[model samples]
Target: MGRTVRVKSFELVAKDINDVDVKLLHALSIGVGWPHRPKDWDFLRRAGHGIVAVDGIGRVFGSAMWFPYGHEFATIGLVITSPRTQAQGTGRWLMEQVFERCGDRNLTLNSTHAAYHLYLSLGFTKEATVYQWQGEAVSPPPPVPALTAELSSLSTANIGEIAALDERAFGANRQKLLALLSEGAAISVLRRGGEAVGFSMKREFGRGHVIGPIVASNDCDAIHLTAVHLRDLAGQFVRVDTREQTGPFADFLQQSRLGINDTVSTMSKGKRFLNRKENEPWVYGLAGHALS
Candidate 1:
């Protein structure tokens, strides 16, 4: 007699932008190295883009998120699968749903070695390598006096200024996405003489936090702002995903005793215009893999 295998019914749902639990499950699966967490779910849904896959019983088995930069491009991340259901194609199914939702829009993601083959099989090509730096607590660095623009939290009143500074640092306008920062997450900005010079935004993922798009006019200001933000987090482990060109920020992570947890390949499938360079002093970290 042949062994019997259960055929689970899979249903993919477009998550409500306000569905917090689903978002938390997605975050927990990726950040805390777990499939899902009950407590944080509500918080995650309110943070950003989220999608979920449920079984016949209505229990979520997998989830993913896409952080949109513009209608033309989005980064996908927070892909997770329940351990009991591994090798059952839950992950692939979830990714397929994400691709379908993305539909002809340019998509990008950072893949770990464990998931590289999976992404390659899905038509993603390697674009750039990103190193993760883990560091020890050090005395908070002093703010750059020359760049001494007082940094402030992003708000509706100052969003236009934030958008303009982002364009100057990132080489493109991301006003649409930057505008979303005022909604739920913490967005910090640096101002000197009442003019914005730099800014950073953060979102909650499970128990940890991810900070990025840390745009600044120079390395010193970037470092200062980052240190301040990290200090605010105190005991929590935070992930700062930055581009290779961001100078002392990466070095600071190294010198501070932060470990380089892993290096991910920033892969893409379609057009490629963003190339890594040494001269670009400003460093920008993606909010997450899905939104990069």
Candidate 2:
């Protein structure tokens, strides 16, 4: 939609997304070879806001979704345009609507290379590079059986700790979104000296299980938390999106046979995107770009 050209007289109009419209959004993702399922989109919509472009017949041409992690920080994702509507202003128009809701909040997004220039034009600067790793999930025996952190499957009692650690690592409170994403999903917690220090979550996504929103005190605990949830997922396809701040986790995933799939530019348009302290635990893997 960067160019000034418009697709034929389709009479497109923008409107707030409704609960009944996730199917159309799902179609937009698959239209471009992405495997976002409607069920996952529905989960996001429970705590997110979105917009859709439509014509006189009410057919969807484009869609965009955003989650306001807090008053000062937010993230957007699942932006899709129907193949037939490229460069027709559908993507631009829908984004304008979503941005209005963001107001002064810092905005972050993981963008495809094709959309990188578009984001640059809109005031976002590159913050980091996110790599997507995925392949058949394999349960390889750990090189060292004694993982440093004591691993445990998350229970309802662990939600408070998980949410607090997530808030610190993510730079904002995503308690509601986390609750929805973790419901009935595999959650693993890392404890050191009988205290929760890190966690990882996995849920049904795309072709198989996707893990993310992982927070840890260090690389060792991060890999251990990931390994705990991934234990029984062998042979099932799995995916994780992560910034390359740690080479060991990426190396570990590769060692487990989850090959690097694609890379995206993680960009932000805001001030103070993250508040950090000396030696604070960092986010090891994102919930997914869409929800990040």
Candidate 3:
């Protein structure tokens, strides 16, 4: 069963979002001057699902998303509250709406400074800090044959393997999201001995391009795959949210001239075990804080 409510003089309804709601969410993202494109919103909703708050006039004012991977893991993200409706309890209401549908699965979200305490009150503890590296990209040196010799462009045929790899790294199934994000974007895959092992993508976003969701067996492989795509994005503004644990990877981005732009906190309510291989750091860069 679904629940409904009324806030102030406006009759508010909380329900699953449709394409129309996504457009409204996109407007909110742009109103806040965030970098997410409308297409990105589509990707998230299409990949998993979300709940939205709509007023009497059918204007969507708030939204929260969750991605479920089987019965084990899920990521809660893309949370946005309209500036006009801030501090009015709409945010909390929207969060509750999402929680009701989350069931007993573990939940994760990357929090902005403003919403940290709210999440804390909800029992989401801090996991690790993530940093955003952004700036004009530089021309990367030619790929070392030993490294990129096996790297190739990604296509529809690669989605399954990529999603399986992502599950091992992200602990979630985000095939739909990856496919939409990779559409028309520069996607590179690394193969060793004819076996797919790593991948990276660069997409037009925010002020320019962003490289992210880069998953590889290790930092070296991650860097190589990302570098293969970075060379083509040279002199363009790019953003990547690097995990704090990967200090060397973050430093390499800085040395490559991507300045540390900002930071966000990755928090979770339940234990989502990302039991991964030791040598495989998996994700050297994220798609974005909103989606992570």
lDDT of each: 0.62, 0.78, 0.76
lDDT digits (tens) for residues 1-292 of candidate 3: 3455566677678867764655688898887667777777776677778888887678888788887766766788878888877778777877888888888888888888888988999889897788888888777633332454487887865677678877677877778778777775788888777877888888877678788888887767877777777788788888888774455566567667888777888898889444557866377788877567
TM-score of each: 0.73, 0.92, 0.88
The most accurate candidate by TM-score is 2
Cα lDDT for residue 215, candidate 2: 88
Which ranking of candidates, highest TM-score first? 2, 3, 1
Model 3 scores a C-alpha lDDT of 0.76
> For residues 1-292, could you state the per-residue lDDT of candidate 1 as single tens digits?
1111233544434344344344546553655374234534443344447666554455555677775555676677767666655677666766777777787877778887777888999999887877765443444533333545686676666678777666655445667666654555677877778877677876565446666768775666777667766767655666676655346666655544455666788887676625544434254665545445
Which regions of candidate 1 are displaced past 4 Å?
Answer: 1-50, 134-136, 140-156, 167-176, 179-187, 191-195, 202-205, 231-236, 276-283
- Ranking of all predicted structures according to lDDT, beginning with the best and ending with the worst: 2, 3, 1
Pairs clashing within candidate 2: 213-286, 213-287
RMSD of 3: 2.7
Q: Per-residue alpha-carbon lDDT of model 2 for 1-292, expressed as tens digits?
A: 3212245875776667773477777877888989888887777777688877777677877778888876887889878888898777667776777788788888988899877887888888997888898888776624533586678888655577678778878878888887877785788888778878888988888899888878886677778877876677888888888885356777778877887799898888977464546457778888888877
